[model samples]
Target: MSSFRLITEYSLWFILPALCVAGAYSWLLYSKKGPWSPLLNKILFSVRFILIFLLCFLLIGPLLQYIKNEFEKPIFVFAIDDSESNTISTGVAKLSALKKEIEQAKKILQQEDYTVDIVTLSGKLSIDDITFKNPSTNLDYLLDKVESNYENRNLAGTILFSDGIYNQGLSPAYKELGFPLYTIGLGDTAAKKDIILKNILYNKLTYQGNSFPIVAEIQNQGFEGKDITVIIKNKGKLLDKKIITFSRNYDLKEVEFRLTSDEKGLQHYEIEVVPLEGEFTDKNNTGHAYIDVIEGKEEILLVASSPHPDIKAIKSVTDQKENYSLNIYIPGITEFKNEKYDLIIFHQIPDLQNTAAEILNKYGKDNSSIWYITGNKVNYASFNQINNALKISQRGQQLDQVTAVYNPDFNKFSLTTEEASVISKYPPVSVPFGEFKPMNNAEVILFQRLGNVQTVKPLLLFSNANDKKVAVFSGEGLWEWRLLEFKETGTTKVFDKLIGNLIQLLSSREEKRKFKVYPINSEFYSSDPVLFETEVYNDIYEKIYGQNINLTVTSEKNEKKHYSYVNTENSRFEIKGLSQGIYKYVASTILNGKKETSEGEFLIKELNIELINGTSDFDLLRTISDKNKGVFLPVTKLSSLPEILKNSSPQSIIHSNEELSEIINLKWVFFLLISLVTLEWFFRKFKGGY
Candidate 1:
């Protein structure tokens, strides 16, 4: 059962050194020899010289002998691992103890005549004469290597030392190898107390007059049922703050905030959550968002011929917002400047006898929103001359028998058979109007015929003629609703919304008088084409125009791109797919030159969402190991891994069994010696030694 293994690598140069030593010894012995000597003495001296020469050869390091007791039984391989994570806790101590245990096991195996192969499975594996580098601590890979290498040898068992964490290589099933897994876990299992801001989200851009929302998610670990505060700020001003409560155990909470733009350019803001005690990192607690607020203030010019409450009501609403600057010019006011307004409203203006029609035609040809309100005091013939779409005819007298009712229910308003078809294609809304003559070159928005009334006309209509937009209202019943049901039902909000909807429509149409261009960001380059858009609406929120509109662009630099409007429902016109840079655009309808000019500016900005730190506790690693029947050892148990592996006997198997005669060839050694001796004797006989 005991055996010695010798391993040596010698070159032909070694033979030269042996020859020199032999020559030197022979000279020293022969240099002192007498010329004549007894034959017996000579033979004795020769035998002694041969023995000395063999001893000298042994001392020259021809080969090295490693002797040890080898067990006649099968061999078992012990693999030990040393990796970075294994040093987390008592890993070093565990590894040392495991080494001692393996040594003891080896001694036991030797005494029992059982072969044992000691291998270190650190970053790699090392056997008696073979070594593998950077070998993963994964027991599966190591076992597979062993199984393959020792396929024809008798392998009694295998022992592995490692920290339970197997970060590299596939985790194989111990059952597949027909072995048991004894995993030694390492590292601390206590959850580290920490708080993290999981995520943040917000809109990239917003209009100057609009408000946007921001959302964020926060997660807490080790602290539950706790209240946390989140705060949002712009520049140095505190915008909003909220307190949120977290559920017991680790919980993820969501928070939302609203932000409104105040200027006509870029608005920057920061959102952050107040950190709790023992929070891990503050990097994730805060984030920044940027929004571009476009300038969209529209100038409206009012030209009312007669004093009326409707104009005052409309002015009151329009003038209340700084965004809408209203310039009123009633009839008989000749000193008013004509070019100062974006929209012109005509109230019961009977005629254009004082060059007013010429001025209006000029303005209309230049593209402007013109609103006409019909009344009894107006000369319909003269007004029709300027805008013939009104189709006004002379009447013998002004009739006052018509009484308008406040209809709260939108369904009660009856539409003519022809008008019903158009109304059916759109979203339904309550419309208020009086009967008027339907004219050619005009699209009717609303229609109604009073009972016993001879005249039946369009209540509302839009006309595109001579590159001009004309909007006509047949009757005035808007205030009646506010006074009657609005006051009775106390649903003032609904009434306000209705009025707001109407105003939004009229103002949006008038916005085409000037082009408004907005940049996507503050740092926008001047070479980029600005984004141009507008919202089109009717007085009653009824969408009269498609969301898709057309815009003719002209820049100070003489650049142009025809943009087709994309309808974003709710009367918004969006012109997308634009190049980056500064530009001036005139947005308008193709039928009319009415355009709103605005400067375009945009800056390219990159938004980044930070990654969540650490990992989830779903135990994905454990699941993977369990699925493969591999041992899942915590980082802390890595120290005692050797003992655990030893207990498992993971490598207990016979890789191969072969007869001793196959390994050792005694016949070959004897044959080599006989051949050398025969040659030597033949040389001596040829020299006539007899």
Candidate 2:
């Protein structure tokens, strides 16, 4: 039972002031009557006596009624947290026990004539309902609701059941509710012994033959000072492996590996750390990455009406370092066989003879990539017999003099929507060009207008029809860029990058049967299993099977992961995940138990931390309970909580009551009277109140 007091007890102090005033009034009347007062004095004394009687009546604070009901009953409230994190380990069992205890306590409170309220902490609010079903746990939300709803009700105490893992709510301990908190902790306190791949970092895009870095983070618990091996493989071939030690307790270790693009198109890389002994799940031990590689080297056929510096300049740029191979065909002299190149560039071919027109048509039909460069000598008549596919006008005109303009700003050309996919990175600028329209299947890569000429033509274009690709340059001034700007460097790096990019774009043919493998990281352990898988795609993007594929996995430590393909009824080819060390894998189809291979390679990374100490530390629970004035009970003692709870009581409510006369002192009234007298005196002297 809680204690209570009444306001009437504080009114006793008013009696002294009333008696003083009455006595002073009686004395004053007697003194004014010269100590011989008669009826008038007696009447004044009687009035003082009545005033004293009234004052005493006011002093005796009254109450209509006063009652006290005392019993051993105590109200109890159970606030339970039912969040997702609470579902770990033996949480359900602990929660069940907590619920049973709450029910038992509710019965006890009811037997003692005390009210019990059950509040569930979840995504929403509830009262007196102990179903305790919620998708989330929010302790602060429940407390706020309780504070708002139960403000007038006298709460004896509160009990809390949770895992101490609060993500969506405020701290319940921070609220100053003047109540004792009894917390029941749920879930396992021990740190779990496990290994997890924390992260995998790699580039989104890579160029063919370029080396890219792959970084992996390995997090380990309970394993320290123990050597672990990580292995990497592609398809099934072992690429690399490394062995490393881990730190005590739980720590994150980083491993890096280098991956090279072997074939064009999309390349898939898988990196995995070998599973440690006594680890949880192996799913987190591996990660996957993908990159797109466009073919860079291309064979280009150049056909021109006359040999000029423009052709030489374009050839010089294409021929360096085997980026692109350029073949020259003069219009009248050479009757060329059209079988050798991916793209064919035409420079001012003036005559549309039957043989040349037929060749052009054949080139277009064969899907041979082509480029048409227009100059003063060329007219529509020269290209008209070729089915007018080039969109060239037929009127030929001779120019007296054409000045080459070297505009650095021509390199900043922006790509249209159609060209953005392939030509996204290159800046486009106006190049000097003559008149010509791109073919129906052609896309303009660069455009320019000739000396304020109303007709603007494509300076560079690509066509996809007939399996052919064509690039058209409508001017001859590009050669001057090399001489005026590049000098001995052939052309500026920007121009080189442009040519390199163009070659890459034109030569990119989706691989008919190709597979690429990459290791997530470079280092691996010999004891760790190497993971390798290939995403096989047909020429048209339909998934295909590499049945009975043989993958030869080799490790730097002489470990191997060779395996014959065991078809899993799927197109993907995979090998066993590996351990610490640098490893590689080469995958191929096996015929008669022999490796009849295509292509494959990969790398495996190692874990960095040692495994001396076990993962997890349970000291946090004790620390938290100690800091918050709560008891940290063991899991076994959870069922004996009712007795401890019954013993605990609500915090004492401390109040300091003062008498009314003490609060309303006469000194304030005396000061006021003195101020009024001074004001009256000042008014009499100066006609103003002070």
Candidate 3:
């Protein structure tokens, strides 16, 4: 409801003219003495006077002040935890009781005219479904969701029902939610008689017939003087076994197991601990890992005109890998056994002495991939004729000291974040001072940077052209790069990874599929997205779009599901969530009116960090509530929380305002003046005074 009033502060400016016009009109009417009676004359004069006065007074603008009350119900929200730990921490009863309390709270809030929303936090927030089996809890992700949903709103407060057991990311104590937060701690703090398989560690790749050690850690609580047997098995075949004795109530033990890999391809191993008398949560008692065993060693041929430290540096790294057998041959001494090789690395090969061309022709004609490393000794003109991947034109024997700058668009494979950083800081290498031009399609990993100017010239790259895989390193000083890497990081893993990645990319078999569908990451965690990307090329190797591909996923339990995905702008698709298991997929599409199919397998590992420490982190919960102007309510005290909110919400909507402007437009003034003048005219005509 609203009220209106005419603003009369400036009425004095219009009042004088109104009175003068009224009196003048009265005189004009009275001056004309007519046959009408005195009463008629007075009435006529009064009508004319009122009409004239109204016309004069309307010159001043009038305004109406209007106010309205808007009732806005306060928004109240609840985020409930539904992770696997909920069932472990005396939470079954508390969760049941809390559900009842929540129903009661919803009724009270609705009756009090509050907008309520309840969501379940099971590694994510959901309103219609609840799954308490999520393996991990990410409090940071949950809080971020809450902020995104209620920011800039009258979010009176929020209620969180969780066990304070977060295993993934930042704790809740560090968040500034900008509103009141009330937490109800679930789970028990009492230690129980339990045993857990904490973690398993092993190399992800190994060679056939090689023995690799697997390390695992176990934790025991309240199981003193008890012996448990741990067994390692692959495909249900026993590999190794050990018995561990827990001497103390709470103990952590690290054990090692050595097993021989006799098979090829991906292998799965399960490490399990025999349960004691009364352990109920058997999920965490077993750990598993996967290792890929290569069948045989692959030979790599290294050709250089003479002895150099760079060759020694490269040899040291390749010798450590059991899968690659490296052979080095200087031009004058001996010839490399080109009998059967997987890859060949040529260092400054087309020299002014012209000694390395015959060896280059011997191995380069074959289908095996080649890597070219150039330095001051490389003859630029002869090098251009030998390789068609890149062309360069420079001044006579001038050298360029170029540092390595990583290219962000390299997507062939991946380099660790730490390795990229280390390579960027190492000393510069010597390249020809010239204009470098690449004529073929190349995926560059490192670019050349002279001083501070980053250039587009490729310092290290991989290319696939004319049915051959070629990699190029346009400069050298790898020996310096290796020594600097070791001096700084105290290990050559970073450098080895850099070179190893290039070797793997160039040495791997080429893909001949026209219609291809592959996962961005073959190995995924339960916390990560299952992402797939596709590539469909026409006859001439040009990428085409608008392809409809059908896919079927089969789980280890033989459950199969079908899905269809058309390409996005980037030719990608995603399944945002999946359970932990081994999944194989077959993707097929109609290309050129023929069906083409590609199949692959991917693994999703479960993240059980939240279940390791099952005790309640009540201190973290208290810190969150204390800093956010809220109350920390335990499960026993949860009933009193709604009462606190009830007391605080009376001032939820203290006031509101609105606008109404019907009279302020001044249209009513014109209608009132016309009505008075019309009435006077009708009366004059009836009294025969017209």
Candidate 4:
């Protein structure tokens, strides 16, 4: 429905002046005619008057307003599950019949003045597009798409048909849905005889020669007192095997395999359960996992003046990490090698007797990281000589007890709020009474708190001396802090975190290179995208792009595939549709007239989640229907869906829209003005008036 009205900012009285002026002009021009008769003269005068009046009236800039109302029919969505599980129990013929019934129901709804649309897992379906070929099922993703696409529209409800076997996304049960949901159940609901490898648990990373355990769960059904053999393998070589006896019809047994990490890089392991006769599909009997085994661990050296509890405290935290190997040395007591280490700790070393001058001078020149824990026994003269970043001037050999005051502005590393709070309650330790001085390059992690007064003196800080990372702890009794943390929290989490963060920050070094490329991940599923990231830098180590990088992937069968990708600083190169195997890749590029390359290995495994359990779950369908205030039925009752929707009283919505346009801008108005002027001139000429 639509309506039109003429509007103006000025009053209607303004158009009368335009009318008077036109009439006077027309009368003056035609009153004294040469050869025309009075009747013809009057007709010409009237046409001239109307045409002139319209031109003058347009000065007021009148506008034409139109209001339109549109009525939209209620929309109904019929969604179907297009996953492989739908055809597992019901063959293609039966599934095709079900699609016909759904189409008939949609036509009926359309005849009843309702807009109906059919959709599948991917999107809106064509006439013959329901093939049940999608590899996985995600009903939750389908529902989310419907809700987002039809939000605030004339959508009345949705009708879903599925077997309720979703393995990709969150369960669609009990979630708040704006529209009513009606579900049609499919697939066989009876339990079948099958053996499934349900799950596998293992570590994702370990060092070389370390033993790691993998546990696989074998779920048995309808095979009581039957023995099943489980085996694990790597690269087609058997590593271990086990036999499990199921005592009941439905039982779950766990099999464990402990294997040494012999080879470096990404390692793929496959676990399988031997199939038995009369058992359900063997597609779900095998499972796979990958572990990344690194070649070596970082070596840390701990040098001390004497055997103190602080040394034990630091060693206890470092021992928990598998990537760090620690060695303790007393300069005079034991013979030590002057080997290169990742990090060195000096605990009250550089004392009056043993300064460790030879060890410090050698490692210091090598730019190795070092941490200094100072106490009352520290020799200020020798310690201050090591680095001028921090200096202590003793006053008569006095001692002061100081607690920790955390600094929130420290950005070197991160510490949790709970860890900071726990540090505040730690017991104070003895420090030399003196005037403490720290250089401008020092970043203080913790300051000294003297009896409830926070001071500007550094208790724990980090600084760089001649390109070597250095840390200083200005007090003793770290063991006390660890004990207090465990006693209050039943664990040493806070203490361990503080020490771990410190070690990580001081030991880590950035490796900057030019023209490098590697895969983003070492392991991926067949459905997952294979992506590689690249970095091309100039001589000064600034990221540069526009270089062409060539990649070569060699499969286990010696088949090589080559691809060339243009490098972008912010994006990754994506490769698609590679089958299941272990692949070795080499990425090479030329920058600044030099050839550089990087090589790595990755594994692609197949996903069989849909075949793990093929039994139908009608109870899940009913729960979804009831939660959204709708109905659930089997596939046979699909013909009754139109009647149920019609009884629900879906209403049509009317949307009102208003449009305003200037009257002078209308095309018809311009044409009408030209026609009137032309007619008046033609009549005058025919009447013999020039």
Candidate 5:
């Protein structure tokens, strides 16, 4: 187990000369008139020769090699699946038995001189404080933990116990753990009698006073000649209910119902299936959904100098949207008294005759966003005075037809690659001959193209400044662009989406609230973190921290929990490990001697992966065990793990390390050389021969 060697990279021919020099020095020092005995003289000459030999050998830079042995005990990783799936009645009763089996296995492995590490697998992997309350199961996450924690150690093998029903992530079978595995199968393999509410389909947004549809997928087994009632409710009030009749023992049904959205803001709804007489589990009989209802029909007003085909083209797009109402007017001839529209369109207005100067000046700085379209009739000096978005220096009154070139860097919103490609090839639009100069704050969505030449002119510009949002299109004849877009593509949906993005961007109002609280997700997969953000703005609309935001969560069981936290960066707060259920929360904070409160609801849905099929996949366990050169055992026979590992590969790893040492730098060598020279001197003086 241990050895030493002297080595050098030089040729062997130099060793003879080095020894001869050491012989000559020893004879000159000790062969002269010395009264010492022949044995003493031989000993002195030998020591002298050896010392001088080593001193000469230093020139060759000799190295000493030492080899040592290191003993490493075999490592065994034992992971327990501590997810909610194992908490069902079938697995719940076996908890004590599982613990006993694992304990016996651990004791036997330790007796075999193996290092054991136990871990728990769930939504997240942790130490072996096994709690079967994790709402989700991620088997690969546990394997990743084993790989990270046991790397660079004497890892011999791994043993796992689970039902083999993984949800929320990839299966652990595919992960290359690079070690043999021994799997113990858990959970029942026979199908259980259960009725499950599989999934729901509905829209998240709808108009108030209108009915929306909700659809549910229902799956049932072993429940023939039975009726299951599906009910929908809101705020503890029943909205709709229906009974489903099964035609066969195993049935799949789709049920649809309509409910009126009569309230604004976020509305919470619950959907449930009445539990059958002999169902396996009832925790999955209910689910939650939400909808947001808003006011109907955004009002859009279009003002122009006279009736043109462009007015009809713009109206065609807005008219198709059930949520938009379009009204038209000829600026000087029409009576435009109402200012309640969400957005105003100014086309060739504010001419030398001052057609819409008053309306344009009033809305240029206010909150109502405006869109401008320029043409030959738009008076340059008067238009600049009315809308401060863009300036134009006209060389003549002539109108030039130019095609559109889309800007890839425009950030107002996104346009699909196909739409951007199609719009770039559209027919030319009419623009007054001039140099179009947009302000610094403006973002150009499109630039002007003269034939094949693209120019740095604002064909379409958007700006938000002075608390106002404005969009200007320095051209007309968009009716031509619409026609060309339809010609290129079979449908106008692409063009419609382009126009819709513009309208949606312009119609959106900024949030000016001083106090706000929002959740990252209103619905979470059980075991997911429940997070909320809180913001308190001063009178100047800047966020300030150091205030306690008290949050209260009320469960459906009428249980209330209180929590208080102070806001940090970006006014954020998060809580984790919430179970599956519907709950309402209220956030309250004191601001400027006044208390403000906001309320909302969130739902944590259960990870129904285990419920998807109660039957365990023993074949999956067999495949994994066999693939890793391991064996599979039932939950009842896990006690033989230690004997199996004793006969496994790599019983005990004996590690070896090689270390190098310099002969010249060895302390013992230096001390021995000095002692030898001192001994010879003392002996010669004692004999009166020096």
Candidate 6:
């Protein structure tokens, strides 16, 4: 409803004078006797008098005020749980019928003058969104969202439809809500006979030739004194087996399997508790685990011309790792084997005699990576000739002491703040006094700090040439660094990390593929999209795009599915709607007239958690309604919700609004003034009163 009125700040007494002034002026003008009839004169006089009086009133600057009030009906929220668990106990046909009935109830509430909004866990407020296909449910999250979305609105209450089985978020029964709750519970509350593999525990990564443990938890219901065999297999090959007897109903047991990992890649294992008669579901009776096994320990060879403390320090750090075997050989004392190793460390080698010439020549051409640490006794000419990364020119056999300065621009590896800080303040090491120069391709990790100034000359650097990694250290006080760190912090962790990172970088092999595609993960759920990542590179190893790659996916039954990658994005390819199974895929692309292909396999496991334990918890729903000051009912009584909400006496809200404007600003007032002036002029001219 709205109303309008005119008001003025000036007093009403000011209007009386304006009225007298207008009447006197109009009577004087029209009282003249110039060629006019008396009747016409009186009529013209009244029009002029009224027009003049209205114009005089404009000086007061009156305002027009308007007030409006709006009434909004109370809103009722109907939230539904759209999860797969709802379809477990309630079949599809019944669920569909129930959904139609809920829609009818919405129409009834709207007819009764109450606003009804239908919402689901997906946040879409449409009846079609209740498909009962969402993988999980969270009742507490739904309640929180409704309260937040309609905080200050005229929300009378909420009507929720759920199965009381939430597996994603906190339980709704324990939460305190702001509005009254009416719950319509669905699903069966009685327990069913089922055998479920509750959980699996194992390491995702381990080394080959090492034994790892796999523990599986099993739960059984209504199967007392029943014997079952739990078997573990890999690619249909049985590795271990165990027998268990359920002592009572609802018995839970754990079976452990210790088996050696013999492969060097991702290994998929299947754990099954043999199904019995009359089971709720066979999907949860079997569990799967994928473990990636890395190749055995890496071999490292340390060669030196004489006994040095640096060799001992390097050996101590490497010895602590089970995946690394370190060997030290002093030229004249222990015989050095020329066998191939993952990494070779030359400590002040290529001395005055250049004794390591044979060893360097042998492994230099092989796949073994090399690291060089120079001391005072190292022959500068021999050192410069061995590695192309760094070159040094000694000045009359002199040695200089220098400290380390970290280079932040280095991208070959990373270091912690504490490690970089402690190493920068370390005691100076002895380096040959000379002109030091590194190649353009060398990546410097540490620069030399000369007394008070830091120089661009590299103290430690690495380079890759012909797919071989080479590192050079220009100083030789590594042992002192370890001791200083241990002295200050009672541990040499900082020192060890610095060395470990360098070794790991040089020892690891670089991938030589110019184009490849692989699965985003080793395992995926049946509901999840099977995604693969694709990468293409030029001859120089820079990223390239706009290439088409074809894929062929083969299932265990020899069924084939073919697809081609779309280059909308440079790195990701997605495939959806695949059932649970093990699949092998091959991706191939042609570049530079050569065919390159990548092959891999992935496992899609079952995620039908709703069928694992189809029992509902209606007691939780009752508790929620009781605590929130409402009533609970089975889904059969859903139509009676409208009557219950009416008893709560939901009232509509009235919102009032007011607006003010000057009367003179009204468009009709301006048009009226023009019309009165025009009429007066026409009548005066026709009657010859001008």
* Most TM-score-accurate candidate: 3
TM-score of 3: 0.76
lDDT of candidates 1 onward, in order: 0.52, 0.55, 0.80, 0.86, 0.79, 0.85
State which candidate has the highest lDDT.
4
Instruction: Evaluate model 1: give its TM-score.
Output: 0.35
All candidates: TM-score: 0.35, 0.34, 0.76, 0.70, 0.73, 0.71
Model 2, 518-539: lDDT tens per residue? 3443333433444445544444
The best-first sequence of candidates by TM-score reads: 3, 5, 6, 4, 1, 2
Each model's Cα RMSD: 27.9, 21.0, 5.9, 7.8, 7.0, 7.4
Off by over 4 Å in 1: 1-268, 274-292, 316-322, 330-339, 351-366, 400-440, 452-456, 492-690
Q: What is the lDDT of residue 502 in candidate 6?
A: 88
Model 5, 1-690: lDDT tens digits are 788988976876788999999999999988774687888888878888988887888888888999988889889888777777777734665876677778778888888788888877643343435667776677788777887888888889888788887776787777666788888888777777888887788887789999899898888878877888999998789989999888786688998988887777667778899998889887777766767677777888888878778787788788777678887878657778575878888888766577766677777557788888877678888777656678888887787888888898998787878778888888888888877778747898889899889998889888877766788888878888777667766667766776777777777777677777778787777656788988889998887888889999877777888899987776458777677567789999999989988778877766565555565777778888888888998776776777878887556677889999987899998898898888877776787767
Worst 10 residues of 2 by lDDT: 608-617
Determine the C-alpha RMSD for candidate 2 after optimal superposition of all C-alphas: 21.0
Global lDDT of model 5: 0.79
Runs with alpha carbons beyond 4 Å of true place in candidate 4: 4-66, 87-113, 117-138, 168-170, 301-321, 326-340, 345-359, 370-513, 538-548, 568-571, 590-595, 658-690
Q: Which residue pairs show collisions in model 5?
A: none
Of 1 and 2, the candidate ahead on TM-score is 1
Q: Model 1: per-residue lDDT, tens digit, 158-196?
A: 544444445456654333553332333433444556566
Position 460, candidate 1: lDDT = 59
